[model samples]
Target: MDVIGGKWKALILWELENYGVRRFGELRRGLPGVSEKMLIQQLRELEEDGIVTREVYREVPPRVEYQLTELGTALNRALEPLGDWGRDRIERIGANRVHPVTT
Candidate 1:
């Protein structure tokens, strides 16, 4: 759970899954709220965990892209049902009440 647990990791994975391959700038743009430092940290962790692959291109400006590994693909697939359930629960509770007050 730790490998993919967090606010941004799963979202990052989902984005990669949807887009196939994404560059650093692309991911940064896609996730508007995530800071560059946090994104880099998360990507590094994911790469170290073998859930993501990073490729670099040799060029003047340089280019780097990220993709999900086999393990990452399986993990994302396994979480599909969980994602669906969350969506349903959110709808049932209403988006504005997703985090209701607790006293």
Candidate 2:
């Protein structure tokens, strides 16, 4: 739970799952609220946890991309039920009535 537990990490994983391979700029754009430094930190943690893979390419501008590992896919599958339950709860109780749970 600690691995994927964070305000932005799960969102980052969702973005990666939605988009196959994403560059730093792409991820930054996708998650406008996240600071670049925080994104970098979260991505490094994810990579270290074996949930994400970072690829670097030798190019004029130096390109780097992030993709989900097999473990990440499994993690996402595990999270789907929770996500559904949250959505259902929100639909049933309404967003204002649903209290956000913190770690």
RMSD per prediction, one decimal? 3.5, 5.0
**Model 2: how far residue 63 lies from native, Å:** 0.6
**Tens-place lDDT digits, model 1, residues 1-103:** 8998888999999999999899999999988899999999999999999999999999879999999999999999999999999999878788548767578
Report the C-alpha displacement of residue 24, candidate 1, in angstroms: 0.6
Q: By TM-score, how accurate is candidate 1?
A: 0.88
In order, the Cα lDDT scores of the candidates are: 0.93, 0.92
Best candidate, lDDT-wise?
A: 1
Which stretches of model 2 miss by more than 4 angstroms?
Answer: 95-103
lDDT for each residue of candidate 2 in 1-103, tens digit (9 for 90 to 100): 8898888889989999999899999999999889999999999999999999999999989999999999998999999999999889778677545765456
